[model samples]
Target: MTSFIRVVKNLLPVILLVVVASSAQGADALPSWSEGKTKQSIVAFVERVTAEGSADFVPVPERIAVFDNDGTLWAEQPMYFQLLFALDRVKVLAPQHPEWTSKEPFASLLKGDLKGALAGGEPAIMQIVMTTHSGMTTAEFDQIVRDWIATAKHPKTGQLYTKMIYQPMLELLAYLRANGFKTFIASGGGVDFMRVFSEEIYGIPPEQVIGSSGKTNFEVRGGTPLLMRLAEINFIDDKAGKPVAIHQHIGRRPIAAFGNSDGDLQMLQWTCSPPGPRFCLFVRHTDADREWAYDRASSIGRLDKGLDEALNMNWTVVDMKTDWTKVFAFEQ
Candidate 1:
């Protein structure tokens, strides 16, 4: 008993030190975010809405925050990661569909001529999307996506696609959730594809993820119920569709919105325009060294009008190069 008491006495200061350090860490919720106005604004907004008795205080149930996935939550440099996934899926599925060897976009893809494959424009892209995303049970598709994302690597960084998620955004999501905010994904990526990984990566469940989707057909095969993806267009959740989807899915206006491109402009506008305390933030990809940097002219994740509006409206704009202490989780 004496020895145990002596040991406890020795460890008491260390335990207290650890507790104090943890408290300090928790005090600054966004550790990956650099000390700047952008970070300050985010922290301030969260505090204002979460503080009890404050005029801007939002009820816990109404503290909704939506985030765009691709370029906002993760890197979408060379192209959207889902497009890369589709290209890889084509290569894997080509043996089963030998006709793809001669098909225009498929042929170009199989020949490693990316430019040629996409040159046909939306029609070509739709064909690719339909070919890869349809004709499978939701469970089967989920497993396939799970398998692919588990091993897929980003072309430029060679990091696992999951590892490419932005560290700062991850912290922000956690910070908001910690403050009683319900974080959701409102992205342009495929709903099924993003659902498979959103919860694991962003702490958002499948139902909370809103995005472009292919149609699904309900069927019962041999007493087994299943929903099979179909090769047809369904609702697209992008640009103007974001607020509409949010209304349909969440049934409440979000207090905060985060995004990176023109596709997100309307979502930000909708979130901030309501007659209540609101926060809108756009992430500007400005770090060419740490990550690819392109805006306005970029084919993928183009910021264009969103950047202009954010500047004009005085909405918080996070400069990835200036605001983030680290880009990827792997950096730490």
Candidate 2:
């Protein structure tokens, strides 16, 4: 039986080797993304950047990656979180401002006519935000946001708004960070609003988030210096403003960028236009059953011009219907 024991011992090493190789292969494969050209391209690009001894291997500091919020990182379907906040603000302030009972947008909002409420366009939206978000200290505003997020439930899904974040995108963020990449969120949403839960939700800190911001004044309040928010618009971080915000906030051009819709087109163009190793990805919402299916026609997060440019620029387009196995964390 000595020969039998020797044979078993000899096979053990081979078995161990096979198991290790299989695990390594699995690690390289992102099963979360479906088997297709898009998935293949994403993996290839990541491998090129991450592979040691490769010419395209970017160092940590230079490996800055910027992602657009809203439809890219999370689900911005039915309506945006900021719009919901505006609606809630309208509700709260309705009792105080009885004139809103006869106002166009406010009356529509009170009557639950979303379409009518938004008919007044950007001007109306800004009015809602200014009225609700202004006249408070930054700290008070932050606290108000915190309180709202803690109790706010999505109007249609009935789920906590934070829980609606895409699971695959969350995984992607972790994967990028694990590969020594620093990710930042450059969104059109209010900076304070995003800073409220970005760290807890996406592992992105407040400093890493750049968004539309209001003017603030430095003042000594009671015992310490405080930055009081003024009732004036400072920067609107959208469209062309995206690249400027990136440059001002990050002080460096990003090597990688991810976004959805035309608002982020400029940011992606800025990243990929440079003569160097760069990667840009556009998250396409094509899943109807899971979360949402929108592209050309949607009022919010419309992916028209950006979609055309993505094809022309050879950017990786993540097809939500095929690429992702799951959408939101709450889905599973």
Candidate 3:
């Protein structure tokens, strides 16, 4: 053939090599995560543990990873998403509970005064949750949560609650799972409420999700057996309760733990304290432009002691503004 045609054919392999290299580079497991120590630490930890014959190599069955919901897995700013669900529920059941119109927290919620409703702290939140979440069968409550989560939108972002999940975290979960790690969610969020969307949104099944829960009792309603949710707390899986629930539900200590606030400090301590290789990650919400910026002083998802401890222990604390190339999946 001509000299020009021979030259093009000879250069094809070099061009192909460049294309292959570019493709491999673009195939990052965490596209949403920026290249930094925060990302490197996570990748390095997974590699060491999953590598055969490595000192830190952990067996597949022993490779359990737990994540906290709320601010950890999804957005919790503008108040907890569960609280928003309860508030909407109150309006739906308003005609039945006229007394709520005059109640302290309920009244404030009905009047769109969120600050006043939350003034009573945990007690007020508990009251609202019980009122809206109880007096129904477990199946009924499940359907309610499913329906609400499917349609609910964050007031600030105006995006569906599920869409508010951190894209980087989703990548981490998938990457870990691909490496034979079993992922679980241990959060302060209500178990049933989270179960409704955990599998759908995070690829974590309901059985793998552990959270705070209310009491439930078996009953024969209309000749059908069912569990009736009671208006009382069975467990509050936050702080110390997280470790307890993980122990009870999982029956094994996890090798990795992820959380964002003080509520998750105990879980992190428990996971990393044992004499073995462990990974503890704390996602610090430092992006006000893309998401939110709050830590020590914020009423919700406050990261006070956890922040100090993370530094002292040299635990991985993700600076959202720095570590994450993108926060939510909606972002370009």
Off by over 4 Å in 2: 1-25, 102-104, 221-224
Q: What global local distance difference test value does model 1 have? A: 0.92
- Give the per-residue lDDT digits (tens) of candidate 3, residues 1-332: 69999999999999999999898556898989999899999999998999899999999999999999999989998889998999899899988988878998989988989889989998998999998999999999999998888888999988999999999999999999988999999999999999988998999999999999999999997899999999999999999999999999999999999999999999999999968799999999999999999999998999999999999998999999999998988987
RMSD of each predicted structure: 3.9, 3.9, 4.7
Query: Runs in model 3 with CA error above 4 Å?
Result: 1-26
- The order of the candidates by lDDT, greatest first, is 3, 1, 2
Instruction: Write candidate 2's Cα lDDT for 233-300 as tens digits.
Output: 88999999999999999999999999989999999999998666899999999998987889988899
- Go through the candidates in order and give each one's C-alpha lDDT: 0.92, 0.87, 0.94
- The alpha-carbon lDDT assigned to residue 265 of candidate 1 equals 97
Q: How many clashing residue pairs, candidate 2?
A: 0
Q: Model 2: which ten-residue window has the lowest total lDDT?
A: 24-33
**Could you give candidate 1's per-residue lDDT for residues 119-231 as a string of tens digits?**
99979998898889888998999998999999989888899999999999999998989889999999999999999999988889999999999999999999999999999
TM-score of each: 0.92, 0.89, 0.92
